[model samples]
Target: MTALRPAPALLEAAFEAAREAMVLCTADRVVVMANEAARHLLPSARPGSPAPAPLPADGADSFQAEHEGRQLYGMRRELDDGHHAWFLRDHTEELARTTALEVERSRTAFLAEAGRRLSASLHMRRCVRTAVELAATHLADAAIVVLPPERRQSAWTRLLPGLPVEEGTLREPQLGEVPGLLEALGGFPPIPSRWLDPSQAPGWLVPAGFGPVGALLVIPLPGNAEPAGALILARCGPAAVFTSEDEVLARIFAARAGAAVSAAVLYREQVDTTAILQADLLPPELPEPEGFELTGAYQAAREGLRIGGDFYDVFGPAGASTDTVIALGDVCGTGPEAAVLTGKVRQTLRALRLVHTEPAAMLTVLNEALLQQSSRQPRFVTMVIGSVHRIDHGRVQLELASGGHPAPLVLRHDGSVEEVPTSGTLIGVLPRTVVRPATVELAPGELCLLYSDGLTEARGGPTGTEQFGEGRLHQALSECRGMPGAVAVERIRQLVSDWVRGGDSDDIAMLAVRAPTRTPLSLRGGGAPAQSPYVIAARRGDRRPRNF
Candidate 1:
């Protein structure tokens, strides 16, 4: 015989063998039939009893409930004769997976937020405070951060839930008060959180009135090449405790905080170094109370640097009749490389002047001294060295020599500008370099300007490519005829700055020496002689002070 179909009544038996729990209920809400699965899924399900409290209300068909300890999910379908069949299955594993997924997402978001807030600042105080605040809000009731020691003392900051942050430095001896803290600061292997008794925390580590301590952890802050600091986290109450996952997170956060703090420290050190170098390279006090009134200006080619290759110094005896040497030099290159040579050349000239005070003779000795440094790179120098002396009340004589430097310009009181004819071989270049001494004189109320080529070689104009040139400088000097040395130097600098129009420039250095003009005493009412220039400066209506 062919395979015969099961009778309609056998379908009822098929329902009994189903894996999911099935129940048949009457219109009166009484259970008519309960399968084996239903009895195992919900212990309360039985024949002739009210269908499990819910029975899938008026228009809805699906429901879920906790029967005993198992989760049951069910749905209802209408059947013939005012009867209904309810089907349910256990879905505890699926529900558990969904909850786990949500938890992972939340943790990922927390880490992302931590990174964003920590990277926002390069300041140590802000970074450490941020780290502790974040840790307190998420990981613990209170947090503390300790920085590596600079000498004998280390800095630390603490934060409690309701109190203001407290920070101070602690000595090395104080570190022994806490267990595992010194090791953490040393970047030793992680110490298990369980080993430290939270209840026994040091008074200094935890703020006063912090009740009970239930958990404690210490982690090292990582840096570029070494440990930058350490982080401490604590919680209150016996129920609060740290897990392995929490320790990993703390280490990661500490690393980020440490890097930011170390970077800030590095930046501060670099700024301090630059400031010291700037102070050292700046021109010192010029030869004052001497025959000539001197004023100088200097600018570095590099944007942030204060000194390049150009330098100037004046050294000698202090008297109107005595000779004083004025040396302004330019090294072969630019920036630090050239600036290095500038210092060496200046120091050599300073020491040699003790033996040879004569202008040309001192330069020759300086050349020889520089060449003797066989270890140094052979860098050439262009300089104007002059021995100045006040010959009379109205004139100052300058015995000058050039070492392949720009010719000095004299701005006469008649509004005339002329360059002194002085030229020679470059200094510090050859074993035997030629130097010739030349003499010039500055009349009262007149200036003799010595400048580096940076003043004339600046490239900027209508097209931003043309040099300022000597012709323009000559015309500019003419307008400074009667102006004092300081005023003339400032005026020339302003002109050059304007010509460049914010373009990059080489090191510009200018030294202007002017002979004081003698003014006759013109008293107002035959009462008192003329007041000094300094006194005139204090009075309003009086002209600007000068080298009178």
Candidate 2:
């Protein structure tokens, strides 16, 4: 018997049982044959009905087609009977996997770039702004950085395409004003992360204007002893709920920003403290004794955190109406400790003035006091002290004493400069201080200048290594013989500041006392004073002619 051909019904039944979908259609695209898998994939295709769309006509060619809500990949073949045939496979699962991988890769790249931008600045405000922009752009619809109440401000930012980044500050709120914020501020992880509708958000969160938030994350920024602040990220509309990966990124960014802000805050505090301390150490106001005009200038060393040890003061005539004391001194070092010693020296002198009227005697007692403390503190001072006693006709007698200091210069009315002759070992050393006293009469239109070594020892020139030297200081003073006391002090300060190119050298202190010009009536009856021409020329802002 001849092999029997498999019946058409049996062949169709085999097709129905196969897993792959199979469809047979005429060239005109009418479906004539379809297996159970094919009918399940495309319910719209029936025998004697047109195919859903044109079938692929080449061998093993793949094309996408929709069947109900499912996506199918079709492999087409041309049958021997001139009908069009296709093998269909469901591809929706594979497509979803690929798309997810692409999204994850993009997010990873975004995080790395965000981190770089955030760390680019150590400035507190700039770091906060960078963090806000990054989060709003990549991680959330809206972002907020809320500083602790002590910090006093908050920042908000959001992602709105085609618009500029929005940012502003809100005054920090009291703890009781917002629910759950305190817990977050305590460094606790937001449990299940906060999810709230926009209308229900706390007042602090309202500035961000995140519409209908679907998920919110509150992460604390850590500090050494406490939480520095909180970072709030909110997603709105249909954005995906924050995942574990997102939480990790938020914590990292906040930590970096928090560190930078804490450093800035601490730096500002240190600067303010330094300013107050320096102000206290320096003289507040100069003493203006009768028959005298006085001015003083103090410059701290410009180099470091330390204010220098140079100091000056003018006070008194306390017990003796005719005597006023002026002192300029320098301690051995720079910094807060040296500054403290400067204050001690000034106070000791002030106290000594009440008991001692003579400059030499007063300095000897101060030396004893410093020597007593030397074993414990071991510092010395270089000083020049003067007592001005008024005499006949607008003239004063200066009893000057020096303790290992640059001698004071007396710029006389006749344009002659003289160094007061006084000398001794620096104070706070040697058991007994030997201070030599010299007396000079400061006539009308004369000035007495007392200064620390910073003026004479300043290093500068064409080579920038030479000391400004006493000769230069003398020349500078000789030019201002008849100027007011205040003008003389300021001129010297400006010269030294310019000489040093505003660099940090040693601390500088200067004090000047000027006597007023005498009237011709007081010049022993109609005799012209030697100071007359210079005083008149100085008042006109001009130099005196040599023989006038």
Candidate 3:
């Protein structure tokens, strides 16, 4: 049997009781029919205004319509009668919820990406720029990062290991600006981020090409106790203005960005401080005397950027050109205490230079000074103090004295290396010293190298536990004859560095002095050359400060 279709009256009753608004309009824009819900929902659907267009065949689009100043979302369908049937629902709430969820997701992801970008560099400016760019891309049309003056305390605030302990003064605030939106923001404070009402925004804001609507947020960047900086975000009119929720998210982002930027600031300050401290602890440029070529290298232990106690210096007597002094010494230990003792030892030796003519006598006086000083902890020092005097055109005499230190190496004019046989009790270890001067005359193309035990004692090899022995040092220097003083020093430095493979090691200090193969042309001529032609002077590139 065939099923009977529903009567027209039954269909009409069902349409009137339906929840969705329904309307039937002829193609020419005249309403042919309407349900009670449709009439109540869209009063204009009763007759002609303009018929809503039919929905896309794929049903992938919705049209927004306004009735009674309320927003509506619906679709239109083509009926068999050549008319259009419009089906609409009150979607304002659902659309609001979905848009909110999407925005929330975007914000979460943006913050995560911002964190990654901010932490990617230890540079302060880069971190600030990352934060501003991220805010502009996700939170607002424009953004700004403003930093307060740097704190005065040591940059050792961060608890993380492997960070440098540096200190630097930040005198002015730093600000980061977004690419656009200056017009909307107008004039911002030079050092701080502050909010402004749209109506009262500075004159430049609107003229600067900021968007239609104006809303601003100034979120203070949180630090350990006080704020390190502030973040400013702005939006134009008609756009979703700043809401309390937006402010909350902005504050959260500002907190993380602040931490990263603060850390970067601390790191940069520490680096600078470390450089200054090392400069003070290490010898300045090696003195360039007519008879000698000098170069040196120093490396601090891996603990941090702070300088260790190993020290070296080459200085000439006040006005005497014929004789110069060379000193290399290591205090009993490392860290600030050793550094202090190193400085004291250097000062004591410098003062003793005037009174003592012999290297052995000078060291005897230094030993007494070391033993007399009162410190929280007792310290001893091993040192080699030598007096270099020009004997003739092609020869130089080195009078050396050692106190419990490695014997200085001599790379002779011939392809041979020998250690100066000098030894004595360590300074600060005995009431009387046993140092005696050991004199050796250096022919042209010979070098006298004094170094700390750090080089020969660095432990790393195939098994990662072998000490770099004097045998290796001897063999290495054997090949360095006739080389520039700077080249010879660098060869040893590179060799030790490679052997250690960047592993933990003690401080390394080296000083090499050579009698040039040829007398400086300036000495032969009437006056000194404008610049030394020695490759030793040219390759003296190690003077550039080391980064820890």
Model 2 ranges with Cα > 4 A deviation:
1-138, 150-174, 194-199, 207-210, 238-240, 303-306, 316-323, 335-337, 351-358, 372-377, 501-504, 520-548
Q: Which lDDT values do the candidates have, in the order given?
A: 0.79, 0.74, 0.70
Higher-ranked by TM-score: 1 or 3: 1
The 10-residue segment of model 2 with minimum total lDDT is: 531-540
The C-alpha local distance difference test score for the whole of candidate 3 amounts to: 0.70
Q: Please list the Cα RMSD from the true structure of every candidate, rounded to 1 decimal place.
A: 7.3, 7.9, 11.2
> Whose lDDT is greatest here?
1
User: How close is every model to the real structure, measured as TM-score?
Assistant: 0.79, 0.71, 0.66
- What's the distance in Å from true for residue 210, model 1? 5.6
Quick one: best TM-score, which candidate?
Answer: 1
Model 1 Cα displacement at 301 (Å)?
1.6
Candidates by TM-score, descending order: 1, 2, 3
Going through the candidates in the order shown, the clash numbers are: 0, 0, 6
Runs in model 3 with CA error above 4 Å? Answer: 1-99, 149-195, 203-207, 210-213, 224-226, 237-240, 300-306, 319-322, 332-344, 351-358, 361-379, 429-433, 460-464, 494-506, 518-548
Name the runs in model 1 displaced over 4 angstroms: 1-141, 159-166, 209-212, 270-279, 285-291, 316-323, 369-377, 389-391, 521-548
